[model samples]
Target: MSYDEQGYGNRDSGGRGDDAYSTLGGTRQTRTRLPEGDPGAPHGRRPARNTRSLVMAAGVVVLLVAAIAFANLGGGDNNKATDSGAPGSSRSDTTGGTAPTAPTGTDPVTGKIGSIASGFAHDEQGAQSAAANYAVALGSVGMFEKSKRDVILNAVIAPSQIEHFRSTLDEAYSAPFFKNVGLNEDGTTPSGFTFVSRTTPIGTKVTSSSAEVTTVEVWCTGLIGLAGEGSTKPVSDGWFTITMELSWIDGGWKAVTHSQKDGPAPVSGDTRASSADEIAGAVNGFGGFTYAR
Candidate 1:
């Protein structure tokens, strides 16, 4: 049974259920859509806005605790003398005060091929750029559609592995799995809810390098599930790292294989959760971008 094929779920294999994810695991675009011009939003373990405050507050507590502990340790002439000489003694002390220069350069090639971004340059950076964008396409809600899934697979996956990849993926996103994730048997949203699956790259790093083949690890944050009241999976978010092995094929890098594992995720922020309708509206209304560099 296929994603678009009606009879595929009829198979008797019984779906993978919760075990499906045991196997597995970017941009996405400008802001013509959101009036705020924010393509997406961020909520860290604490609100990023309050990070300074959190740091300051934590610092004060540590200082107070340190003072009490130090007094208990002893009244200290030697410690005072040591402290007076400690500053400017270590190399780290002087160097830490200086800011290192950060390298600046042009962003990698970025544009679109059909609905997804394409035209990546031919280099390590290009492969990384390609991998980041490909990850976004693969993880999107659009991949649930057979045609779009095929298009995406064709665009990024090596031609030889396409069939095997599709078959395994189809099985992985099976009917039972869909039901668990709040999707219908066919992976569509129920009435009054909008399905949202989006991947935004946190960063990319080249793990292995070669002229023709390279591997890049993309740290990303994703949002998934239906957005509506009473929805069990109401747009939950998580962190994932996608490791893509790419080959320079036909003058461009294409993914030969990819794998994923759980994060490196951040603390979920203290930001108030948005309403289901609000989440639905944001998912539908905001647009993703073509990531590069």
Candidate 2:
């Protein structure tokens, strides 16, 4: 069994069906392929074999010619040409080759919030970036460090809820929880281990928005744990839905209240697990973004 990029198990990746599939979370028989044999074996005799072979050969030649023509006409490396229209390309108009026009007529309060929201601003492509950065700010890391935490909370949360969020999170980042996640009492990374706690938003939606408030829900899947040697609780992914009640206040959309719930999660897959070093390097190398709806 193997997991695809989407985290779903692919039975085709090799494994006996008797073994339980990880994604399905149960034992399931694998589908078997029929052994190769002559299609006319069951018939009395083969008919017109040479004619069929000649047709197939001609088809192959035609395909080869077309491929070569395409390769030459594309005027670039074949791989580069294919990759040019991939999802990450900003200019690639995958939505039927038409560029998305900018939205017109912004709300005044929303625009004010948009100003500070600019720090957290991102287009749809940047949703994951926003989620990851916001999650880091909302997580234990932001609460442990005094100045950093203050800035994060002040910038991200609603003015009215700032005090409450700070007080609650302060207690949540107690010594025991820090130790549990392989962090120091003060929430710093332990010796030889890089503590990992980041969220990646799957998608976001604005459920409702009024003059003074916006109700946005960010569906996120996060990676949490320490990545390093001698670590038992290595990094693992989690799925959660975070609902935020944001208020247009003091020139920004501030989170008045937020809550999270587990899942909409998919089954685990059989992909080869990446090493701690790989995970650590990937996280460090990638930069997060701010999201806007």
Candidate 3:
């Protein structure tokens, strides 16, 4: 995959055209309640990808980027979306897919390695679930930090590849990159504003599998940018599909490599962008979920 990890909305910006993403941009997710309110209902998972760190650096940036503008944004299959091929069309809602539900039953993770979810079930379904959740974790803002990033890497990455992945990511999270997202060179969120980035998996497909290795594609939508008054990078949504190559290791599946491509992005929505205050509030108040497939 030739890393095309950038762009959001169906509008032209920085020469990426309407359908393409600019350089790398991403954020964590904002979960809105579907009208039905069923826990089993699939909510949108943010667009996710694993970068050169045996994972993805761009996808990691995306986790802290988006904020939901509507309260009951529906998550549905992209194919089912009747997009008018216009910005702010109904497609954003439909791209999420019918299976893109909120978490249900037990939190899929049995525990956490620092903040990253861990202790996955050891089966095909379990592997898919772990990959789905890991996509969100790998795509999180926390991965920018050292200690937290280390724990997350250990939890989801194959041990043999960890050293290489970590080095790759460290180089990727450059000072210039941090500056673009309005963060200090150290990767800390600035005063008074919230940075958003999230990955919501619209659907998952296991392309091939064996007892030792598996290939999965997680089609996801993501939110990124900043929230709060005077924040220059206001929140916006984008979509992408991530393909992960996993190895069943220890008692779970771990990612050995991954890559990101732009979206099966449906049309952007017409919902008014939330005020920085409101967007910041939702980010601070709402806790992210442990995504399940």
Go through the candidates in order and give each one's C-alpha lDDT.
Answer: 0.53, 0.42, 0.54
lDDT of 3 by residue, 154-246 (tens): 777677667765665555566766776667778888988787767677777665555566656677776667788987667666566666666
Better of 2 and 3 by lDDT: 3
* Candidate 2 TM-score, C-alpha based: 0.55
What value of lDDT does candidate 2 attain over all alpha carbons? 0.42
Q: TM-score of predicted model 1?
A: 0.64
For model 2, name the residue pairs that clash.
Answer: 3-271, 113-252, 129-289, 130-289, 158-255
Worst 10 residues of 2 by lDDT: 1-10
Clashes (N, CA, C under 3 Å) per candidate: 5, 5, 47
Tens-place lDDT per residue, model 2, 17-85, is 222111100001111112444656773322334543453343333223212211111111111111323
Quality of model 1 by C-alpha lDDT = 0.53
Candidate ranking (TM-score, best to worst): 3, 1, 2
After best superposition, candidate 3 residue 220: deviation in angstroms? 1.2
Pick by TM-score: 1 or 3, better one: 3
- Runs in model 1 deviating more than 4 A are 1-111
Query: Which ten contiguous residues of candidate 3 have the minimum total lDDT?
Result: 67-76
TM-score of each: 0.64, 0.55, 0.65
Model 3 error, position 80 (Å): 33
